[model samples]
Target: MHDLEGVDRGVNPQKTSVSALALQLEELLVSSDRRGMAQVRQLWTPGYLHTAAELFVRHCQRVVIVSGFPVGETYETDGPAGAIALLQGVKDCGGQARLVGFTPYIDRLRNCVAGLPQLNQRDLLALDRSGDVCEQLQGYMAGFAPTLLIFVAVPGQAADGCYYNPRFEDISDRTLPWEKLLELADCYSIAIADSGNHLGMGRVADPLARLSIVPAVSWTDGLVIADIANWGACGLLALASAFVRKNLLRNLHLTPLLEVLSRSGIVDSVTGMATASEDGLPAFSGEAVVTTLRNAAQTLQSGF
Candidate 1:
């Protein structure tokens, strides 16, 4: 395995050639950069998409994915899309995958995942905030024995052991102890985040903090940063689809998922409304992103 311990500090650019799928996803992320700012180049290390996807495919057979960011009164739109995409991508590879999130978002998650043939009620686990979370997760890990723990747009502990939302002002007692459990469990972990406050940003906290970006307090074996957390998740699908030479992402299904999420009261993080958009971009942006992902898979299909 690659030495990922130094990833939190920042990785020096290597001479490695990145895959076409990763490059395309990176381009997509860069395109979404705020006001032409080079946050992606500045905050994210090179070759992350390829490395993370490879690590997931190589190690995570029974994957446990966690998401759901409380951006407003309810769960935001960022986490579910990535969680579902990664779940589907993992399942498409014939691997078992499950979704985990806070208890408050259980109904939303159920509604979000409803009618999805790849997922079932058994695949969803809620982090009961009122109970002993670590103990509950420990029991869960004992039974599921996940090979890898992935955090998609999920908030992480701050240096003070508290969880903060995107505003970095709202504090909450609702925290998951996945990072603490990862230390004892025999598994690898990856964090997918757009904002630095989410899990996995701890891997790149140094560079990000040098620029005054408040990064997540918890760390992981790998970190994937993007313009939006869902994009990072879709980037993984693109990578997995390319690696396995299969179009795991379908455009027809992508639109309906967002529509369902909107109808279920999942608001866009950017617009803060229950709309068919993610992080403020319209629904067509979602279609365009998935189309690019399919194109990347097609490139691999032709042996490129």
Candidate 2:
């Protein structure tokens, strides 16, 4: 019998909901800017990242960065690079940050299990084996004691032949379930920042069940899902900056940041902009992308 009574009480065995509350508190403390607003609508919809980031930054002192399913071979070329980039951006702006690679053993185990029948016990076992990465990651965190942890899911090419594999989905979400990480980190008082996969990850089957799990995971910081349709890198940077700015201002008033961004018409530019493609995706020019990144960097520095 699944113990859902715990959920009604606003807590999970992993304490996911309580952690989400912490995230909510943080957002309430910060002032919202235009970019922040756009990010809020795009990423969180009814729920918001600014609120979460505010609480996480206010409470945590160290951050651990994790990337999901990086395309291509190991370290130098995978999804982790994006996670590394964000950490570097934070470090460059004078924030404490560290990079942790998910264990390689998990990948090897995956290859060995790929020959099994679809959704067989062997397949499930193989996916379960990937949880070892989480265990190793937890051990590393215990020693480092970071205040915050950021997980980025790297985007891969749509043309890549590796599509429609349910096993990959199971490996990504279940083996290293975010809720489990939140439970482990909560013990250390570390906050979580997650940029879930670019495309909606397994939402159609049970949307509420998926979303419900999110609240159980402690996300005191930002939750960014890159807008794949339009803007791409530009959208991601803009969202990240907005999240950081809102968090930094939790202790202070938000009016000044709002005034500057508003007066400069950055908000209008972002909102009035048309989708870059017929699919309603955003397209950004090279210079525009650079400017957005720079703006995000500045936001991190200014504590907007």
Candidate 3:
């Protein structure tokens, strides 16, 4: 097990070639820096660095929660809120979880759940309309040293009936693409988990592409993905599930998932010990969903 005690704060320059990337991102945060913007254009994709910085700062000290649309639904649900729910679940199990919301959606979620307890709103760096998700993720991982990250995809309508936007193709063209998101998992030593597949949005190419990037041991069928039909939603769940499976529950370097679960009151069901598989993967019908979720949540809490 890797000892997380006394882990250094800030990015390890040797671990990632991100110093140059950081300068470009810093310029974007500074408004009215026309020269900086020009310089950014020559060295990297415009707005890409900014988006990555936003994601990094937002996820700095916490686990990531992502939600989104699936294949069948018209307007599946709010991705940010679903992410929040997962975070809350972690907190409920005595875990420390941070909720990272993508700009406009974050604001909308705040308005939607005005009086909810354990839901404090914080600003994640913006990636709005920049048209580059990969750059955003790269900048985020460079800036924030989060051990776990969850990504959710919301479902919405496209010109051809209902479909998820921001597919892998939409984000992969940039310099640091979806492949980098997975790389961060390996680099930072974070676990990546996802929920089950759904019809609404989980079928998108980006989520699948992300799944392909990570070690298969780190991936899993996430919650919303299993319930919904949209590929976008499924992709988000996959990201979250992967984080939980890899970083939280299964990593021997960190606290054991069983210890967290026992503390969270999820280890023993009415029948007996909760006979769950690693990372909550299938093959064990004896485990209860509530217990499994609680166990996952407890693991997040222990990460902090």
Best by TM-score: 1
On lDDT, the leading prediction is 1
Writing each residue's lDDT as its tens digit, candidate 3 over 150-266 gives 554332222233232333122211111222344554322121112212112222334333332211122212212221111112222212332343222221111222333223222
- Candidate 1 segments exceeding 4 Å error: 1-21, 35-37, 210-213
Q: Give lDDT tens digits, candidate 1, residues 129-159.
A: 6777778878888999989889898877778
Worst 10 residues of 1 by lDDT: 7-16
Error of 2 at 181 (Å): 2.0
Instruction: Report how far off residue 171 is in candidate 2 (Å).
Output: 4.9
Root-mean-square deviation (CA) per prediction: 6.7, 16.5, 17.6
TM-score for candidate 1: 0.87
Better of 1 and 3 by lDDT: 1
| Clash tally, candidates in order | 1, 13, 76
Model 3 clash count equals 76
- C-alpha RMSD between model 1 and the true structure: 6.7
lDDT of 2 at 40: 34
How much lDDT does each candidate structure score? 0.70, 0.33, 0.32
Which digits, one per residue and each the tens of the lDDT, describe model 2 over residues 1-304? 1122322233111333423433332232111211232233334343333443443445335655543442223211122223333444454335656544344523432332333221112211112444475776577658666666554442211223222111233234222444344456753222222222222232221222333222122332344332221122222333344445532212211222222222322122223322121112122222232343344334453442
